[model samples]
Target: MKLVTRAGWGAAPSRYDLAYIASTHGTKIHYEGAYVPKSLAAPGAHGSCAGHVRDIQASHLANRVENYSDIAYSAMVCPHGTVYEGRGLHRQTGANGDQLLNRAHYAVCAMLGNSGLVVPTDAMLDGLVDAIGWLRNGGGAGKEVLGHRDGYATACPGDPLYAWVQAGAKRPDGTAPQGGTSTPVPSSGGIARYQVVINGLSYGYGAQGPHVAEVGKALVKAGYGKHYQVGPDENWTDADTKNFSDFQRSLGFTGTAPHQDADGVPGPVSLQRLLGHLPGKTVKAYGMLPFPGRSAFVLGKSNPAVVTLDNGLIRKGYARHHAGAKYQPGSLFTTYTRDNVRDFQRATPALAGDADGYPGPLTWQLLLS
Candidate 1:
């Protein structure tokens, strides 16, 4: 089997080694035996890579931590065509049947397990061919690869895919290998927001009602509004209108008509600006910095030089911890006041002149960078 490191793949038992050789008597072919989306593969075929393999590994580890006994397989074949060594071929996994049949068996899991997502990817098939060839040839005592349900009661490895496994194929030199094509790096662009915690409270960016107080606070700090109030009920109020008005004004709307309840309530255009829809305005947020600390806001415009300087420092790991969606230091204008700014200016040589500490463009640049 082709074993290498990649995302979704880091666990234990790095690769097939002498430790594995001693314990494993033969090879057992089992499907992660789960289902996966077709998008997992390339456009034309089911070509997988180390990255895809790693995703499966990460999920498996997460699953094991949640409920299972241990990682379910000895090794797995990602759609990317990479084989990952599970608990090593030597260490026994609880994925197989009773002890007698489990020992001496090297299990290989096909990514996506057996959930019934789609036809197996060609790359996955190639991986299967390569893995079987390696197990049958390299292990000396050649053995047959079987589905999970073959010995157990469950319909593991699914029906359609498992049927194909029952019919074996031959190998030349007992190995299959091929080159790979390029694929784009995965991004979390459209992912759904999960409950993000802040100051011991649970909230989501898309949530509504009292939860919106946090969102409103984020908006105000981001420079979308000026008026913010803490109600007797501790809930956010329409003081958010100021932010909506500021955003609307930025869009070129003029006079009282712009602020009027023309559409009854705030429209999508208004919300869009709050969410950074409109262009040019700089929106400052608390960032992912940890609590009990202060977050800096870079105002005016987004200067590339400033941004680059800040990012460089962040990359070097000097900035405060990431707070996700929470704000800290309470009132930026008050808590930071003069003392905080003076302290910051004193500590950082980047700010030469006034120890006044009030962070203007240059001061903010120096402090953030």
Candidate 2:
């Protein structure tokens, strides 16, 4: 429940003036959605929390595509029960899907990610509760406390944290503030049927495709591409296998045994860890356009799905709001694209209630179809 000011964390000056909100629908919980070092969760590592927050700010600022004015969240909580001020108080958040969605809730990010330090300590959960209470009391946040994926197609805030949100964001002592509800999990709009399957056999010797390229790129990003001699392109060469084996070893998998974890064959668990953050169809899956998850269309995200969305909007004649004389369809999801999606949602009776400017699975399907 300790609070750290932005100055204490050495936050850089925000690039743009943050918009203020008089009130919010509630507080939406979030997590890093990427890898976080295990050291951050260790005891007595509280001193490093500020640096971690600062690093997050640096990353957000460096995201040229998102063009984020500041670190997207209103506040951040560490595992040691310290709350760091981000774009604090009534300021609008960029972490949510779009402007409309941003206006609907304040964002609180738990300093946890998918890999390494995935689980939250009891202290962290208590810190989250304290952060939410602070928002409700002074930030005009409503009674509702929800996860980042409540209305968006994301696995953000991850399952463990989101489960806490759904369970009313209770503290470790089993006490929660009044007016919290168990928010139902949102529908994926049939997104469950599609998956990014990396067939183990398809890799190693002579395999080639966008999927191979994706694995190669992931391997490089994960710091295991040291064996690469030429290309991490479409061709899956010995480099891919060697690099993948290194990644497996890092995960404590050794010897090409019964599990094949170290065989460099790209098992489901290792691949998911390496590329879980990647949304949309990075690999060609028989020409199927997977829903790409709702997070792909959020402001600041630049993904292939955004490009598809832009093209679909234009084809559907929703281009009036986004397309200009010099405008060309691109990957970046900006306010213009959001407004266009909103326009489409308003025009379509099926989407009228769900029009928050962010494209959900149904919106994507309808627009493209």
Best by TM-score: 2
lDDT of 2 by residue, 312-353 (tens): 787778876644684457767888899889999999998999
Residue-level error in angstroms, candidate 2, position 37: 1.5
For model 2, the stretches where C-alpha displacement exceeds 4 angstroms are 178-369
RMSD of 2: 16.1
Q: How well is each residue in 1-369 modelled by candidate 1, as lDDT tens digits? A: 466532345453333332334445455666543224223443433333444444444444445344333455666775656666555534555566766556657667775432212235556666767665555555442455666776777656654446556555322232322222212212133222222222223222233454356446556666765655452112333454445445544543223231122211233233333453311123233221111101122233221122223333444343443244522222123322344456656666756466664444445434444
Clashing pairs in 2: none
Q: Give the TM-score of candidate 2.
A: 0.53
TM-score of each: 0.39, 0.53
